[model samples]
Target: MTDHESAGTPPGTEPAPAADGSPAGPAGRFLARIALGARHLAAGLRHILTTGHQSDEEIRRTLVLRQLEAHDAVRDTAREELDAVRRRITRLELAGAEEGWTPEQRQQVRMLREERRRREAAARDMGRVPFVPVQPTADQIRRARHKGSTVRLLGLLAFLAALSWLLVQRPALLAPAALAALIWLWWSGGHPPVLAQRPVPDRLLARPELDPDAAPAALTAAPGQDDDQDQDTDLRHVTTADEATARIAAALAKRKVHVRSVAPAVRTAYGWQADLTLREGTVADVVAVLRRLDTDFRVGTGRTLAEGSTDDSAIVTLRVLTSDPFANPPAPPVRPPLSCSILDPVSDIVSLDGEPTPLYLAGTSVLAVAVMGGGKSSLVRDLADYVTACRDAVAVDIDPTGRGLGPLRRAALRTAYTPEAAEAELRRLLAEARRRTADLGETEDVWQVTPTTPAIVAFLDEYAQLTPEGKGLAIEVLRIARKARISLVVCTQDATADVMGDAVADVFPIRVLMPCRKADIGVTLWPSAVSEGWTAHHLTPGDDHAPHDAGRCFIWAPGHKRPILRYVPHIAPHDALQRAQERLDAGLPTLTATDGPQAAQAAAQPIVAVMLDAFAAAGAEELTVAELLDALAAVDPGHWTQWDTRPDRLAMGGREIKRALKDAGLPPVPTVRSKLPGRPSAYRLQDLKSALDETG
Candidate 1:
């Protein structure tokens, strides 16, 4: 066989046999095969290691504590293992010699040991060892210490660098930094430590057997421990505050604590605290003492065992402060519910404050204001009660059909049905009003007109019913609304529109609306002020806002109706009634519901019978002035005398009388008609004697 180096064939091809022409034998071929197998095994191991395909056991072996030693440490460990193996081999040889071993056995043992040693040495060189940090030489350490000193000096210079720049800018910043440095030096450097450093022990710190009362030892080897054979821990040393401070100083000294100064013990609201300053000794030394102290004896705030605390030697707080004595609890918050209500009516019984402003209806600024409901009749009934409360306050009602004003007719200052009768009655009322106005002009103050002579409130219902001379009585209402002593509240469903009439525009300063479906009416009455963004949509009618009822009305007086002012509460119902009734029951001419005289039985029978029959036949929940107008607006708008100024109501008695006369076979009861002014055309049935002979 020829060596590959001397062979001159191509580079990668195998060499031919030598001139001896001997083929490569089995032993060499077997060795070549073994070498190839080893190369393949090495390639497989490389793939596993690089790609992390190695088994868990392989990784564990690679990263174990033995493999994780520092680089030099691992080398030293390898060398030591080699030495041990060498020693073992030597021992094995001695044992073999003592046993008289054969040469073949000895050779085999030596070969096996040599192979194992080579494998271990190879593993050591192949990057199996962890890296160890290089240790600096003594001179290098000295150079590092000098560099550290330079860094510290540079730090001090850096602080001055800011001041120097500031000095360059203004030349004023140096004085303060210099002064501060001087103060720091004086405070830290000049102060003598109260206790000096002494030797301490770890065992003594862990479970300290301290003798604060013991006498000073001649020389304390382990100064923090009381180790003399006869000496014991002095438990009495820290009994008083002063003694406690001294003991603390001694404990600190044993740990070589260097503080600037020690402050006297101070008392707090809860307990006592001691302020301490450490100077010469480092933070590491003081940390040992801090950990050794009682668990309950916590460090104060800002107190860290950091070396050189002159930079920020703030005191640490151990406990929290108590809460303030004056702090108030939070109040619960909730939203107000939405609501509205009609607060103004004669019998509404509610005042401006939503309290009762009862039986008396007087001094209402809303002259000719209208209400439309069955409930308003209750309010009108109370008007009689109000008139009784104020003697001079007269109520004039014209219930033509005996529906509304008829019940309280007797209490009216003047009651009339037909337009002619109403005109006559109103002439009387106006004469009284003109007289009262003249008297009021003479009075010093308007309110001083006396309780018996309070302002009068004339309430009128179904305002469109009265039409005299085709001009309509709404015009007459305007005159009374302006000139009469009493105020007017004229009620009708559709009166909110042109029906309200411009004639009374100057008189009615206050308008109280009950609910209505008409959005325009609410906006007209409210005019969107004092409602805080009052939308027409928010004005729902009725007493749904009964809770927030009082402020619902839009008050519109000259000086009193400013937008900024909140609505005042209304007077309640029952209280207003009592005040009115008291005046009337005192015989002060206060009008009352009961003050009216009951009509004769026959007359009442006709009214009650007609009312019940109309209600039953019509089946109306409630009759309204607007619905009645619509009912009559279709009818002869002119001949609606039952709704207007027609005196045919004598027809009831007249019809009965004429029928009786005819049934008895007598001449028809003579019909004599009055050509009364401002009245409907109608004939009246009179007695035969009177009709036949005026001479008699």
Candidate 2:
């Protein structure tokens, strides 16, 4: 006190009482500094606690939104420039007549107009930029909040506990510690000069930072190098399903096609596929834009394909082929074991994605339609090879071409090379089906094929070449042969209704459409086959005497609701011949007499027999055609009762009867008067007896 009085000459000054009535000494200043440090510490801790709680997904979403906002800013700038150019052009136009502008002024206006057009194009391009939303799920937010709350509570408690300990044991050092911590936090808040001066990690940059010494060479690099790098970046950016969808959307938009949404692309061995919902367009629109998409995606021509969805007209499936899927076709399926069951799938058909799909031949009729050199014969040979390798199956070849079966003819149980033989085989198959139906138990629907009673697989090649009666017999067999473990594989080059009737084409449960006319697909397969992604018509056929996409086909089966592109395995003629010989050496199974001679006799009996019996029952000398038909219906209701009434078959009443009678070599009986409104044609009982006697 004495020293202070001597130095300042102010008695009882007490540091002159600071602004807040505190002593203006070192202690007050120290207290102020400590308070400032505490405030800084609090703010830093608060910042960490608040920011640390954000989930990675939330941060990513924020970043994406920011990027989109940046893009919007760029587009707005382009629009502003466009508007400015338009205004300048307008000003020049207004000044030209009044001020009589020179050549330079007119050229300036023209250049401004060009600039406006370019800016407009740029703005449009920006608008077409694809955007896919990525938002955090409710569950993610819940879990993140829970974890952040737990961590923040624990941190707060830890800080409080440490402060309490410091106050109890080392209160003297608390202020200094707080001060040091505040200084450190402030120092770390900014980018340190030492670290900021150094180059960032290469992985952190979009493209690696060029070496200082090589920068000159990089600048001098060819322009193609930059183009290549840009292309690579474009390709790499589409590594994910979301990215692919976005890219495809952008590409389609450039062609004036808008889509509501595109499902995530599914990766396949061939390439990738995605289903899209169009905003307001047909599938044909999408198909039209595929060529441009190929160019945009850098895929080669014919790599992109679009098909309408069968369920909805607005839905389309887009397939992008990245590579040649059939560049390396799979080897032929291995031969079956010593005695494979016919119930199992016979061979493997490789799908477009290079996956092996089993081909089921039993319990299903197959219709294969293809153009010339479309590999129909090769498919037939492969099927025959499989059948010959099975112990519970026998092959029947009905080819009017005689050579359609190739060397596999050796494996057939019965080979028919003429229309008459084909009809005979069809009748025998029908009889076998009838016999099997009668033999089944009440609870059993399908006959269980065995070695002793094997199933029959009839291969009817050149079906269009068959006679009308033969075609009719084949259709009859198809209608009833399923339960008897008998199926047909009918191959045809023409699939028109006149060539292959609707009734015959519709009966097949399995359809194999090879390279043919586009119209043939709808006729040979289902009406919705083309819409369901059956693009067999797009497949290339042989040209200049060379096979192209010969084995490619779209397989539509009962189990497959949508058509799948498949490649039928090719079996060489020598391989097929060897397999046939092996099967013949093992001794094929044969049907018993009940299924052979007796069943054929029953099937071969003419419709005249029923008519004759009806005449006998009527006990009349003469009856009109209508009266005879009615009598026949009562005698044999199974065959004659609903003959002309079937919706699937052509309706012919009297003409059908006359045709049958004429086929039996019977003379036509004249019309008779039976007191009816119209004098109808009649068949006399004596004439029926005479016809039956002559045919016998």
Candidate 3:
């Protein structure tokens, strides 16, 4: 009792005796250990069947394998996307080359292609370096250390259990067990646990850098280095003269135009020039097939030219410009000649073939037709510069808008800024021409222009703005002025019948057609000129609102039997002004007897004076605009009659009168209710007198 109490055992509870009624001994303990082992094994089996539990090593290995599989799938998807993009770029390039693309579209495609290339380079980099090393996180390291310790403890326990069982059962087997245990210990000590080793972020195997020899040719070459080589290759493949002729024949044959014989093509700075004798079609048929020829030759639009020969309509001259002929225009003359003769050519223009073509402005009328911003003003300024340089020429500018000839005003003999004043100036010139013709007296068919008797070159800008009567006067001057050494240079936006009457338009032998409407080309030149590759209508404007072919034109002159593309050298405004000032300083010649200050003064009389004279002729204190216009016409038949009786629908005689009065600094005409039937807006004589007095 005393011992049990000291050991802290309950007095009633004690160990049961073994089956032999004896105290539990070593054999009984061993049997109990076996039973405990059996129970533990059964519990493990239950856990396996119910939850499918896995060891940490198996879980980690499975995670690593899944991660590797996912990485491969992502790489494959990226490759597929890159391939799709490459295919799309290829399609766009092929489509663009087959058809045509605008500059903006081409630029967009180029940018897309560049982006695709950059992405492909990134994909290639990823492909080269298949994997990346990843540092383990703190939690991962802790788990790995715990797993390593557990595995070492399990190995030690298994070795001890095997050694004990072998020594008890068979002593001879103990040697083998000890040897196996030593090997296991050595392997466990040398190698790290599976979870403890550093993880590979990507694949285990990585490829090396691509070999230069195995790389694509485009990738191997340096940027822009291949362009020269490609250009050389293209030069080697340039179309020969015979090849060009054959291509031309093939191109024309598709359009049902037969070529009988072709001359050997002559290589020019641009591309080629050849003469062809047609068997079944005229030159128009050849021109009609230019688009097809451009495709066959791998050139751009408006690059081929075809026109009939002067002597033989059956023979056609074909020209093809491989590159843009007008990409770089020739520089204008920095300094024009200070003194020249009217008999000689005024200026030299460059043709498409890079040859200098002379423009003769002495005895013929020139009509320059262009749309707005088509470089018509530049043409006028060029002419003004030429005339200003002439020693035996006096330029008379009639610009209704007043801005066309503003820069060369100092060089002009007399400038008219209004339709009325222009009409008056033209009338005075007509009188002078008649006097000169009478003085000739059949001695000479043409007047001899000299420094003393200078030729008169009338520059009329915006001819469409002129009244019908003014236009009629201009035509009359054009008809009789050439014999008297007088020439007209008319510039207008269009040459439609309504804009420039066919009667006057036909008389202009030298026609310059700039970029304009398709119909304008036909109206400005002969009907056949449009069919002869006179492609002024195809010219378009650039982003700056100026024509792409600004100074380029198709000129139809008497010397040029067929239309030819020519570029008029632009004359800067400052240069024109400087030249004109120099000519003025040198004392330019004046017109004959009829072009002195008196005639100019009469022609340029103030509007207020004219209005006052009209008021006086009406013999009334106040008169309506219509009445004033009628009176003004009666007072000055040459200047004011055109306003009242202009045949066009733009006949605004009353409005013109009102503007004239207002322009003279007179108050607005008030509507007066008189005893007459219609109470119309009228101007008073008192107001005109006051304005005239104030101006004086």
Candidate 4:
């Protein structure tokens, strides 16, 4: 059995044990160490409630009160232990006959209610919130709380013993053990994280396992070195750790390699991972001054992810030196260019930022979950610059608030807004995702993207706007998050904890939090982020995730432990819109865009998407032409005067529709020859058809 499984390590997390197969791998061991504290507390609590061994009643009661205040295991927390004790008391009273309520029951409930009032009053006086954390952390976390364990154990045993002494004890008194076990399981079960499955050994995926004598591709005691290797060859047939390490030592030995000792490297499904620590040496020396003994070791470089504070750093990388390695994945597309109208700014990334912030995770996708204006809009704008145009790429925006493609109009295969629009676009993207997963799972040997084509990105902006529209986007985001091909950049201003309910929100395993105004904290943080009166200015955005300026962004790639601020190369949003128009004008085939005949309609009355509201107020009747003209004259006299009087639909032509459809990404529809089948041409704007529908 793996170290994690045998140690009762939580599933999906790395094993926890020392090197040589001890009971802790980093993944399992860290959690175990963390979990160990809880076990001790629980044991202590059980002893207190059941043992009845209190030397001093006042001291014991005070201990219970403080324990309740510090204890975090229960569903609800309290400054007074009475809150939890009352709950237990209430449970006991309810389950047992009302006659069971002793003087203790009434006292516990009274104290509990008193504490509740204190907390409630405290909450009422709080101020506005400042930001949102997609990643939820324990608000009341402490060094290590062992309060409940002892209090509960002693308390429970005392209750049982008291009942037995009273001559009314029942066999059910033993039920405490069962309850403690369940609670322990719950507390412990939550300790570990789920990690990606370990990749098959190179020998397993390639050559068949041979006998002890035969050894072409089996998990050999040591994999052999290769002289003429293909650039795209799998690591299984390439090299080994011993071979790579010697090169590393030779490269930096002269400077006094303060190597902390390299542990046995384990291969993952996507790549290999091992820890590296430097005592006296710096990262620059490892990269620049280190001379190459064998070209293989020097060929690979280190990649790190730094976040929260600039002072902290972790070494992460994908190396080409080892042969029995994880399968290499296609590099994710860089951020695509923004609108041609917007000037793209250079990023201080390579210099100011010490580590590379990869947009995509191999065998894992990225998740961006934040309340809006926290720089999500600009971040999407920046991502437009990360991806290349050739991966048959496209982006669809489900929001109808005019951010159809955000600033991604230039490189997105196509872009769209509105659920009706997003639905059509998602169907196509989802289809492709399903196709790749089933067809290329083995042949392409990739768990995610293809190298030659741009992967489709369906970014939903202002997702909360459609909550009233019932598009089920909340759930859809989660489904797409775990799948292949498509990556989601989801943005919303809604701070509701259970947006669209659980089904949809639960799927989004990854989340991103953004800067918020303290006043809006109550609405945004839900039960999360308890601060109030916080402002967007407090959030830092950068490649390593600091506070945001104009071009900065933050990322939380999978496998990363925290959010990172990043320097996103600035791309103009308007220019992105222009390029999207250009691509549409070029008749580029795309799934969706501001390009189809829909573009004309999309562009004609910017207010049309707002429907009659833009036409008038929130609610209005179907008005006559005169009323519309009057309204237009009040807001836009110039257009009102220019509008033709012909009620038979103004004579419109391709120029209007072509301009609109250019960004819709679909080709302009053929011109309409007749007003209706077998009917003569009606007096209408010939240009309107192009303006209205692509092929109408």
- The numbered model that scores best in TM-score is 3
lDDT of 1 at 632: 28
Once superposed on the true structure, which residue ranges of model 2 sit more than 4 Å away at CA? 1-247, 262-268, 282-302, 307-315, 543-546, 595-696
Q: What does candidate 1 score on TM?
A: 0.28
Clashing pairs in 2: 625-681
Q: On residues 148-169, what C-alpha lDDT tens digit does candidate 4 reach at each position?
A: 4455656778987886665444
Name the TM-score of candidate 2. Answer: 0.51
Q: What is the C-alpha RMSD of each candidate to the true structure, in Å?
A: 40.8, 21.7, 28.6, 24.5
Model 4: lDDT of residue 180: 71
* lDDT tens per residue, model 2, 206-311: 2111222222112223223334333321222356777777666656655556577778887766676888897665786676566677777777554677878767
Task: Give lDDT tens digits, candidate 1, residues 364-469.
Answer: 4442222332134434444444443333555566544446444445445545565444443333334334434444445433333333444455555655554432
Report the Cα lDDT for residue 511, model 2: 84
Worst 10 residues of 3 by lDDT: 205-214
Task: For each candidate in the order shown, give its overall lDDT on alpha carbons.
Answer: 0.38, 0.66, 0.64, 0.39
Question: Against the correct fold, how does model 3 do in TM-score?
Answer: 0.52
Question: Which of the two candidates, 2 or 3, achieves a greater lDDT against the reference?
Answer: 2
Candidate 1 wrongly placed segments (more than 4 Å) = 1-375, 378-384, 405-410, 418-420, 435-455, 468-484, 517-696
lDDT of 1: 0.38
